[model samples]
Target chain A: MKKLLLAAALSALATGAAWADTVRLGTEGAYPPYNFINDKGEVDGFERELGDEICKRAALDCTWVTNEWDSIIPNLVSSNYDAIIAGMSVTAERDEVIDFTNEYIPPSPSGYVGLAGGSVDVAKGIIAAQINTIQAGHVASSGATLVEFASPDETVAAVKNGEADAVLADKDFLAPIVAESGGMLAFIADDVSIGGGVALGLRESDGELKAKMNTAIDAMKADGTLNTMLVKWFKDAAPQW
Target chain B: MFEICAEPRSLEGLTWLSCYLTTPKHAAMYYSILTVLGLLLAVVPPILFLGFAGALARRSKIAPVRWLGVGYTSIVRGVPDIVFFLFFPIALDQAVEYIRHKIKCADVLEPVYQGNDFVVCQAAKMPLGIADQFYHEAWGFSLAVITFAIVFGAFTANTLHGALNAVPKGQLETARAFGMSERQTFWRVHMPQMWVYALPGLSNLWMILIKATPLLFLLGVKDIVYWAKELGGMKTQVYTYAHPDWRIWYFGALLVFYLFLTWVSQRAFDRIFARASRGLSVAS
Candidate 1:
């Protein structure tokens, strides 16, 4: 009886190892449209839908994991998840540590939003951006005093409370706030085109997984499903193929 | 979790709140309260053990042992707790990975610290690259516990050391005059009398430890404070549970939780102090 019990436990462990093969996709669930935790508390947004479709097309079992924005890249490298589909923009500095799949979302303009009727001198005034983002890197180098925030919401909050002269972020993310602010917030400066577009980030060591994801992304692009998703999530602000 | 939760945007009143509080994310927040308690329970044994060890070492006859204990208590107590909380976990993680890299990747020629990155072979990861998610979380939590133990242990050492001295010198001298060895007197007499003096300081330390649980979020443990911030942020119509910024309400809830915990702790400590101080004339 003891031997039989040991065998049963060993079989259970084997099945557990097999079930661990599912690919895990990581995202920051705080950013809306790109990603956000819905009322059901599941990861829901453009990236969520796109990641699921890609997994289905590639014939791979996948699960979602939420991580803080600042540590997203490090966590991916440390193998916390198989991929980062958190609307991360492709940049040369990031390319050194991790590899990227082909672009899923086209390059979009980043705009500065400030209080209505206020003039923001982009060159000299303090601008807010989420830390470790391409926009933050741009703000830091664009001759502006950059105040970095941990979350995207804090950047917008900084602008509303007059802690910053303006908050610069992706136009798609900023557009909805501008529309809903009742004329309290408006675009204060010309949009700046930055980054090489957004894509799925993967560990450099995971070549096979990277190839499979790239194939699925290409299939989505070819069938216009990716474009449909972009429009649905970003409305008219989405840059199309 | 309920059928009505399917359309959260349409939710209203108590029904909406029930669904809101029962979401998976909210469930995680509820579980994090237990995480804070678990850390407190798990840390106490190590803290007391280290405190006793440190206090004894300082009283050692050997000069080196005495210096080691003195250095530990003085150095750790001198640094700000927040700096130690932030620095220890990352430094310890890298140190573990670095040692593993040296052993597992002996043939690799590139340095471990290249430019800004700490590159290690996939096999050298602390939990191993293919380990389960449960292992990853457990690893983070264990690191948080150790950091807490180390910082709190130093303060505990100082309190225990003071208590050891505060045990009236006449009592220990009387034991020595009765032909008792120093070790026998320390274990049987001095240790028993030391508790009366230690209870007050230890109670203060316990309250501080309870308050420090919120800092677990800094070490990436997903404690209650992290969830409060995430759930309280503004949500637009695109989200299922659309709500305005409700951070004030969430923070208010945290305030009540902390006050209740401290209140319960205070009552328990009062009882323990009363019982321990029984025949002694020490103020309760």
Candidate 2:
């Protein structure tokens, strides 16, 4: 029994050592198109496909891990995962804590969705945005009453419930919702482009891994596979290389 | 689900609500109630065992054992439960990872702490990075259970200690005069009597435990509170079952659910209290 226990422990250690070589990709599975949990309960969306392709191109073993969006960056820094591919927009504030590979998806505009025909002055009226997003930062600095929610769904709900005059979020995210709202929702203001493009977030110490991923992203861009995925997921809004 | 649920946006009134209440997300919400109940049921045995051991340790003749028990109860009871709830899981997670990092990455020379980051090798992750989603969820739920047990066990210890003392000294003396061993006297006279005094405090603790199930959200377990906030928020036409901001109704449902739990708990405790107090000379 003692010998068998020792053997089991040794094998467990061996497996743990093997796991060290695999890069873990952390993502927020709540956001659709970028990343979302499909009905099958696996991470399935644009980023999931892109991340898998990037791993294959880099010849690196990788695994997907879902994390809540609020702690995605902190968790990455804390070694909860090797990199973040959670549709995170590159911002100077974020770059202070972690490094980013070159942007895979270009800057998408942020737009305000509101009840159709409502007089929502974007500069002064109450606006809702997901907490810790570029839109929330913009609204907070723009002198509007910014109501921040933890999820994108709640921001839209805020607009519909009359809790806020409008909700500012990614145009790609809001456009589909607005179109499908049956005229109950519409763009209330001009789109505002903020932050750099979306990129994979990595810890500052993981420069080798970042370089490997950046090379993979560049390869995809050069081969047009990247553009095809963008077009498939974002449709007309996709910024082709 | 009804056929009208196929085009949920087209329906209104009771039909829409009927369909809305049974969406997959709502179903998940309903299942989360079981998560709360499971936590309660799983936690009780550990709590009672810990409480019993703690009370006995405090009553021990050995000085160090008594101090150990006293220290455990006092330190845990002194801190607010919310603070413990927030701190324990993160600290425990990091501690586990830190030990794993030491064992798994012995060859790595770099220190684990670099500035604000608690950098550990990928192998040191609590659930291996490649593990399925169910494993991750189970790991988090397990951590939540341990945390609840530790915090609530301390309170239970203090209550049990007091109840042990509340058992009459004269009854124990009579048992001793009849030549009963100390162990026999405790089991026959003291332990049975201790329950009557302990029941009131235990009942209060149980009610608090039920209410504290909502705090599982803070620990990142998808308990009912997490689902309530997620499902109750307004879903737009992009969703299959679009709804207006119905958070009030969703939270209202949660309100009723919690009230029902406490109401049932109150009746159950009352029956237990009456049964325990039976044939005793103590005033009802």
Candidate 3:
């Protein structure tokens, strides 16, 4: 009876773990087009549709979890979730901590958006980017003062408030904001590409799960479905898969 | 709002402002303040009850109960409270779902410890797999509350234990001389008298609880802080309302909100202490 009880308890813990089929896909639901919380408050956007297709083809039970952008990668390392589908680009600094599957969305250009007549000097003027993002890296190296904010909205806000002379972010992301600025803001510089294109980040140890997801992602890339999504959401800014 | 919002770009000054504040997301931010208030009101009663149990257990003659109570109180003090706040919800959620998964899917032969992932059966998912948005939010909120109650309960227990000791020995002896049993003496004499002593510490605990509501953001709940960040940032042309970086303004509003809450709390605690101390001697 004691041995049986011990076995049951151990199996109970094993049973509770992902030893089952479901994979929890973690994303920051704050970014638009890539991923955002919709009016119904569910995760919606390009990645949502694309991630669903990957799960469908890969034959894995996938669930969506939204985590804060700043801690998304660390949370995956700590086993809070299995994968990060957040709009994170592949960067050398991050590669030290987590592994990437493959380039799903090819690296697109990043641009600087500033007040229409008050362009940031780029050499010395303060520039803002969302915290831990690749654009922040480019700003850090470009001889401009770098300011970081927790969310993309705040980065744009920094430019509007004069806290930042300009905000460096994905061109596609800043395009709509500039259009909405109604002549208040405009692109101040040429598009500068940074990092490899965005990819799914997994724990370094999650090789099997990574293999499964990569297969699904590669399949998406093969049939032009990936480009279809890129065009639908990113329009002219999308790079061909 | 209907009129001012019509030509968002054309309007300026306070007219533009009126429409901006009335955006649907701003309304959600306002409602989130009430959510924080609701959490405060809901968690306190249970915390007090837990404290009462802990104090009694500590005072009990039984050796293990006293040790258990002592352990509960002392252990929480050495570790930072915020650690508990951060750790509890995720751990508890997994633990709860884990238990449910075991019973619901007994025949499953595979191990659950897949790397970096914790997968459970579909039916065992909390709020179930297809729960509404409200259910999901409420479930997360509930986990946050329980985490707060448990962590704060330990602090409250320590305070109540000290308060229990502060009650005069003469009062207990007098109650016993008047034919009161141990249980009766506790209920009739010790518990009532201890309140005057406990009120000051409990009030301090209450303030900490009030200030700590901001930590709900860490638990992934869309509390006031989350909404403030979401709604205050500049909205571009695509949004119905657009603005420049207004974070300083939004955060200023939040600072005032918390200040008002703390001010009211201080006044109410002062009144509570005054009433509780009504008949006690000045020295006592």
Best by lDDT: 1
Error of 2 at A241 (Å): 3.8
Q: lDDT of all the models against the reference? A: 0.86, 0.85, 0.81
lDDT by residue (B49-140, candidate 3, tens digit) is 88888888898899999999988877876678778876778788888878877887777765555554566656567755444447667888
State the iRMSD of every prediction, in order shown. Answer: 4.2, 3.7, 5.4
Which pairs clash (backbone N, Cα, C closer than 3 Å) in model 1? none
Model 3 segments more than 4 A misplaced? A1-26, A36-65, A73-84, A91-102, A111-149, A155-168, A174-193, A200-237, B1-19
Residue A100 displacement (Å), model 3 = 5.8
Look at candidate 1 and tell me the lDDT of residue A235.
94
The clash count of every prediction, one per candidate, is 0, 0, 7
What TM-score would you give candidate 2 relative to the actual structure? 0.84
Candidate number achieving the greatest TM-score relative to the actual structure: 1
In angstroms, the error of model 2 at A101 is 1.7
In model 3, the clashing pairs are A17-B112, A18-B112, A18-B119, A19-B111, A19-B112, A107-A197, A180-B237
Q: Alpha-carbon error at A219 in model 1, in Å?
A: 2.7
- Residue A22 shift from truth in candidate 1, angstroms: 4.4
Per-residue lDDT of candidate 2, residues A1-241 (tens digit): 9999998986775573354457889998767668765433367788999999999999988878777777788778877678999889999999988999999999888898999988889999999999999999999999999999988878888788799999999988887788778899999899999998999999988879888998999999999999999998888887778
Candidate 1: lDDT over CA atoms?
Answer: 0.86
